[model samples]
Target: MINLALLIFLVVLFTQIVSWVGKTVLQEVAFAVYSRVFLSGTASKQRQLRKQVLAEKAELGWTSSQDEFAKWAKLRRKLDKGIADLEKINTTLTSSKTSFSVKFNSLLWILMTGSQLFLVWWYRKQPIFWLPQGWVPKPVAWILSFPSAPLGSVSSGAWGAVCKRVLQSVEEIVKAILEPTVVPNGPFPTAPFPAQSQSQPSAKIEPITLEHEKLD
Candidate 1:
């Protein structure tokens, strides 16, 4: 009975660790990878777009910390539209990159979860001949087990929702940390300029005289 409880406690602890890292580290790593692959060849444009959004937020006396959810939504819409345009231009590259990232991240999490389970299984066997019996104290295990119950209950997809909520708080802290002491003078540059489409602009040429004439 005691061994059973200890084993369960250890499993819960390891699961919580995996969930925490998934929320914090893996989320950011995924974002960085996605941005690098999707935004390739458009680093300058992306920077300009981000600056433009920041400038708008500043003009409106808003940051991610502010109560203006509408402002954030507007910014997101603009950014999404820009991303859509880029994706259209590089459809194959974007699709391949996204597929690879999803598979890679899934494999990483599987390996991490598998190793944690293996460690707990190994510890349960008590391979050592003689040592201090208990590693995880009973009282400490009980305390950890309390939260671990709810954590274990949460579904896999639920973590993404939880992470999004957690990131809201984190985003505010990041905004405060990044707040500039010295503000820039001018407004940020606008969205990446639109590319020329099907229609072509008409051109005019000036006639030249026998001696010399200017061309327009």
Candidate 2:
């Protein structure tokens, strides 16, 4: 039989990665080739527009003579018109991409989350692993066991939760390590210390008076 613990970990890890992919890698499946006919040639239309723009640029560059101002101006106008068309395509692509992502990613998330839930239900009575005897209190062990699993056994529910938490922790640590830190433009300023001086007292004239009295 396949190891339940390994399966649970892999599934949880995969779901998390899928969630990240839709968010970070590509916002819309339609714009990327990773999607197979999902967008129904909408992406192809965008490609065609891009090719048209390139063709316009090349044709104008090679054939259109600059010797005649009128001809050059006419070609320039055509190029500008093609560019405007390209911009329209871009605007449409952006809005449609956002629309597609909202629907696709929402559905994707539901499916992925549901798969985990299904696994829990299907193996509700099964244990991913067995905990050492007396390792944890009865209440805690029961919670980990979950559903109908026997005591001192870790059920799918607990294992899935642990896997998710571990993945989140790892992701957080990675982001912390890879994220750029803002440093000050210069070193911190230090305050100067106050100056202190000690003065010595001068010798008194009592010695002169004693010597004078002795001499007198």
Candidate 3:
């Protein structure tokens, strides 16, 4: 009988431990995926755009030939296209990340509630060790024997509420990160005026002797 009781105790303990571990792992994975894929990608794309803009500005200063202007225009168009693509991708990823976090949190809550109930049931089956000297009802003794189960249930509920809040916070953060800031287009500086000619042409001189010889 003692061995049987110990076996039951071990089973309940193991189940609770596994359930907790599973919840922790699920939360970690959710966070990792959001940070690594969604957040990082958005940041990286923005940084690349910024770098390209800087490089274009640098080229404009040194550019002399028309070919250089054409090359710069091509690069600028490519960068603009890239930025647009990244914006679309970021929107999609943000939606996906939010959905995944909500589902994961819901699963955690379900697992926690079920495990608590199972633990309570398991604990009630075990025999009570201590009882009041006076007459104590069987039902009362069963309830008193496993105080942890009720506490566990309450704890699980509170935890689920907290997890839901956390998931909401994460969603907000992902949305903020993914949303690209609208940078207003600045006016491009006008090109420098071409250099003017420095030297003036000398006036034409006519010979006077040719008219005097013709008259003689």
Deviation (Å) of 40 in candidate 3: 12
Tens digits of lDDT, candidate 2, 144-189 = 9998788899999999999999999999999999999998898788
TM-score of 3: 0.36
Winner by lDDT between candidate 2 and candidate 1: 2
Better of 1 and 2 by TM-score: 2
Residue pair clashes in candidate 2:
none
Compare the candidates by TM-score and give the number of the best one: 2
TM-score of each: 0.28, 0.59, 0.36
Kindly give the number of clashing pairs for every candidate: 0, 0, 0
Ten-residue stretch with the least lDDT total in model 3: 151-160
lDDT of 1 by residue, 87-206 (tens): 554565556557766776676565556644554444433321222335456564333333333222322222223444555566678779999888778998787755555356556688
Q: When superposed on Cα atoms, how far off is each prediction in RMSD?
A: 31.6, 6.5, 31.0
Q: Each model's C-alpha lDDT?
A: 0.53, 0.79, 0.57
Among all windows of ten consecutive residues in candidate 1, which has the lowest summed lDDT?
150-159
- What is the model-wide C-alpha lDDT for candidate 3? 0.57
| lDDT per residue (tens digit) for residues 80-184 in model 3 | 776676677667667766777788777655555555455445554343234444455655543444444332122222333334455556667887999999876
